[model samples]
Target: MSDASALRKVMAPTGVLRATINVGNPVLAGLDVEHQPFGVSVDLATLIAHRLEVELELQVVASAGEAVDVVSREEADMGFFALDPRRGESIEFTAPYVFIEGCYLVREDSPITAQEEVDRLGQRIVVGKGSAYDLYLSRTIEQAELVRAPTSPKVVAFFREHQLDIAAGVKQQLEVGIEEFGGMRLLPGHFMTIQQAMGVPKGRSPEAAAFLSAFIEEVKAQGEVARLLEKHGIKGASVAPSA
Candidate 1:
């Protein structure tokens, strides 16, 4: 092997560097153009694979719950999705890469237009099972009667079909839903901030952690991550260093 290849192998961990991220538009922060999954998270994973000179596998789970399962079961070497502190004990996070805000989506004709409306009177808030918004509603809006969808797309469809009074999703996700389906509007405020991170399986090898940290640092320092985010018109996101 070439010296560079040899050095890479030395730094690389044994086995495949598999990764799974959502396939949704704006999959990473707000970086979806042409309704594609060209988000910053996708760019970071692809870049890491290139630098490590290792195979990169990308998997798309239908929902966030499945993404969590991918890492927990060792089916994926890493998972890139929104972070929940409750999940930290089950997996190791490589520092947050992006931050997201959650909001409620409603039909344009719906009476729920503002955050206060959601707090006081919102009735049916559709959300995916195990999604951040589902958890948030369960805590904050006890009377809201949260409806569960199996995937983000189904959540959007629930609202469009008038089966739900509202759907909760990230700001960008709601935007994508509106553009794709053409009849929804965002409620006036946010429920909470969602931090996005790369997660390694619990008790992962040290070499795996080293490679992820190094890959993230290089992507941040070289501006590759930023460039990809910009290419997709994502604004207001910055890479957080791995802790």
Candidate 2:
């Protein structure tokens, strides 16, 4: 086949690439999953599929842990989750695409107003099971009793229902919960720095990796990255070159 024909074949929309979405946060990278079919991570994945001439098939899953296993086991093509160094060995990360800091959610009238104050003795903190916040809390806040909820909303609910003293999550999520559930407050200080990235199964086809790299670069070059961030009202996030 001619190079042009080969390119056409590769870029043709074969079908939607199977994708998984975490049910927790709707707005990521300024793209509200509710408004736009694509969030920051989904947009990144869609761009990759489009460039490769394939369609994107998004699948919503319950937790990041499930997303990780689905992609690693080759059940799905890719996953948009907070990429960490430890998971790097099991999956291929495109690059550090975005950054979000961790924060605490508490009752609006509660005494916990700041992250430092949350560290005081007898404070109980809740976080989603197997999430970045859980890992951070495990390492840093030794004094507070840690309760693990299955999902982000549940973490907030655990605190709201008085099952726990505090809940930990991203700023956007904490804000949304404070509004949705009522009587919740987002703490001032963040838990730690977090970086989001795209991942696929280890040893997946070279075609997929090449497509991911090119798609990420294309979005950055086209300024879609910045636009998505502002569109979603998600601040403190920047789309960087893929590593």
Over the stretch 153-189, how does candidate 2's per-residue lDDT look in tens digits?
5777777676578888877777777788787777777
**Estimated TM-score for each candidate:** 0.80, 0.81
Q: In model 2, which regions exceed 4 Å deviation?
A: 1-16, 29-38, 205-207, 233-236, 240-243
Query: Any idea what lDDT model 2 has?
Result: 0.70
Q: Say what the RMSD of model 2 is.
A: 3.8
Residues 123-195, model 1: lDDT tens digits: 8878878776676677778566777888765778767676678788877778878899887788776878777
Error of 1 at 156 (Å): 1.4
lDDT agreement with native, every candidate: 0.70, 0.70
